[model samples]
Target: METTFKDFYDTLIENLECYAGEYESFIDYGPKLFKVLCDLLNSDVDKSLRLVISAAIGYYVTPVDVIPEQTYGPYGYIDDIYLSSHVLKMVADVHGYGFIAKISSPDIEEIIIECEVKSLEILSDEEIESILAYIGL
Candidate 1:
């Protein structure tokens, strides 16, 4: 059976809540980042942005990522969160944070900002680039 986004979201949240890792704060935005990605994918965005959004969402669900949740548990979500933030930042840069905030929840802009900052602390620029390459972004 195909795994729905909601199902993945539930598992992501459960893992994060039960996690006891050093990157807890950075990974906390996994749900929020996922929510925003789902919202964007459902929205009437242009094709290029939609592709990027879809890639990020695909990365979230796929077990063969930079850090697989199957292996690292919730901590594996760190790369997923960073990729989501990176995609969100791209959308924000093009349409502005207000536009994303409008499409998603109003408070999401702040959460996106926090996720970006926290993700950087855990993953380096080279690591982020490697993740992007891994996902073919």
Candidate 2:
């Protein structure tokens, strides 16, 4: 069965402290994702696409969420992960993943890991589908 969002936070947080290797990758993911977003913004993409991308970025940094970051700590990033993957995939579909091509291997590893995780761990597929529909996707 697919991982429901219900288990996402616990699973994510559980994995965080279990591994022994350097987790600098997690710390680096934010900046790398932001840089990709910046590239998207600077590109000659369509206005609607740009707006959705902006909303995704805004959603990442915004404290407000289904579970507020203030209350959840690291697990709070769940929404950001999901939205970011969606935007990145869309951006890749249009502009190519070359936005991330020049990034360091470790950072690329983090990006690929995050994209894989978020792509699978959608919080509420129906809900996000509705939002995207409303946004004209």
Candidate 3:
């Protein structure tokens, strides 16, 4: 009952897409997710898991791949997928069976979906506009 990397990737992508219109929100959440990942990596009761998480995070956060976000449309999603895959792998490695169990639980999905929806709800139209302007969109 191990959690596959694909499960975690799907969850992260789903949450991220919910905030698509809010650049500031994405900027905020992305780094927080990275920090959570870094902490998880550093807290390796199993050293092997820790190493994988560390390496994956390093690869995920580094912005030196493919086209930049300025390229627009699908180009931006390339980096998103890369980062998502790394995070997913780390989650799967660390949590293993527990992660899979949680993924299968409707409550877990509901909580994530609800949280994502609430986060989006709190964002104001003006705030979104400001973020777009800041990003030169």
Candidate 4:
């Protein structure tokens, strides 16, 4: 059988719980971001945004990412979290935080904003660019 998004989400969450290290707090939002992507996929958003959201989800589930949790543990989720917030920011730009808040949590916007800032603090622009390029996102 083909692996569904739920299967990926469950596996990612399990890995995150075991590997979340110094960035544990930031990594904690990994599940929430995955949930937001799932919610967006089910929402009435346009096709392009859904594609980008899907890419972000793919990046999160892949073990061979820029910072693989398989290698770096919880620290590996930094890039995944960053990409999620980045994609969510793009959606919010189009539909507004209120729109996302309806599908996700009331504090999701805040969480995304914080994750973006914190991720930047850890990874440089070059590193973030490489991560994006790694997945062709």
Candidate 5:
């Protein structure tokens, strides 16, 4: 089945839960994902759109964040949304509409939404500010 942006986001967050225990795994997986994202950016897409997607991916992978995962649980998934939407938008802009037509399962979407909502509730203002600073916002 085709995965939706939400599904991908949840997977990224769930994988991140291993940041402490499976640091090596995260490190290993990151390069491969980064390559795929890079390929998407280098496709026949417009340069401006590609640049935006590249920037979003860079921001998503960076340890710095607008919402730190340590404080926000899965709401950190927002970073994934930011990245994926930019990619999808670029694809549509260059390839045409109906690009990225595959939607992820509803279950995955719910998990991502739940995690984001819970994280938002648990994270403090100070922590959020720190995260934003880390992300250079």
Candidate 6:
């Protein structure tokens, strides 16, 4: 991965640890994630960034999920953190962090920050890879 990707990953991971099980976190963050996705997808960013942002949003809504949200209970959001991290890397790589501020969702940006702070922090590379493969992203 590129340096920017690494930095985003590290930052997100640290933040995720802090937000893992807050109240309403799942419902709050999920829509916020998709809202940001909508903002990015509709932005003037390059086609590649649009595709990545779309994939991340798609991953969020897919019913046949990788980790099966019901099975993991609240912890299911770990995958959410990963997807958010993926979007952040793509956004930072193509447009830095400024575009994140352009999202129109009422609380999506704050929700994303909360998601990062509280998302599952112990996911393994192999586990995440399994999810990506399961989702075919």
Least accurate stretch of 10 residues (summed lDDT) in model 4?
A: 12-21
**Regions of model 3 farther than 4 Å from truth:** 1-28, 70-82, 89-137
Return the top candidate by TM-score.
4
Tell me which residue pairs clash in candidate 2.
Answer: none
Tell me the tens digit of each residue's lDDT in model 2 across 22-110: 33334335445555665667767656678888886666556666545578665555555556666777766765566545442334545
After superposition, which runs of candidate 6 have C-alpha atoms over 4 Å from their true positions?
Answer: 1-28, 104-120, 134-137
lDDT of 4 by residue, 8-124 (tens): 667767776665367777788888898889889999877879888889888877869888877877777889889999899999999999989999889988899999999999998
Count backbone clashes in candidate 4: 2
State every prediction's TM-score relative to the real structure. 0.85, 0.58, 0.38, 0.87, 0.44, 0.63
Candidate 2: RMSD over Cα atoms? 10.9
Candidate 3, 10-69: lDDT as tens digits: 444554554546344333344334444555644433565555555545544344433344
Candidate 2 Cα deviation (angstroms), residue 5: 35
lDDT, candidate 5, 1-137, per-residue tens: 99756544355646655555322322323323344455555455566566665665766666656655556554454444433443444455565443323232223333333433444455566765554444344
Clashing pairs in 3: none
Each candidate: RMSD to true structure? 3.0, 10.9, 14.7, 3.0, 10.2, 12.1
Kindly indicate the candidate among 5 and 6 with the higher lDDT.
6
Ranking by lDDT: 4, 1, 6, 2, 5, 3
Over 4 Å off in model 2, which ranges?
1-28, 99-113, 122-137
lDDT of 6 at 50: 70
Tens digit per residue, CA lDDT, model 1, 1-137: 99756577787777688766787766877987888888887776666898889899999989888888889787678888888988998998788888788777788878888887887888878878889998787
Model 6 per-residue lDDT tens digits across residues 45-133: 77767766767766765645766555765466567666776666567667755667665444445556556555435567777777667
- Give every collision pair in model 6: 15-116, 15-117, 16-116, 18-117, 19-117, 19-118, 20-118
- Model 1 CA lDDT for position 28: 78
The better-scoring model by lDDT among 2 and 5 is 2
State the weakest 10-residue window (summed lDDT) of model 3. Answer: 106-115
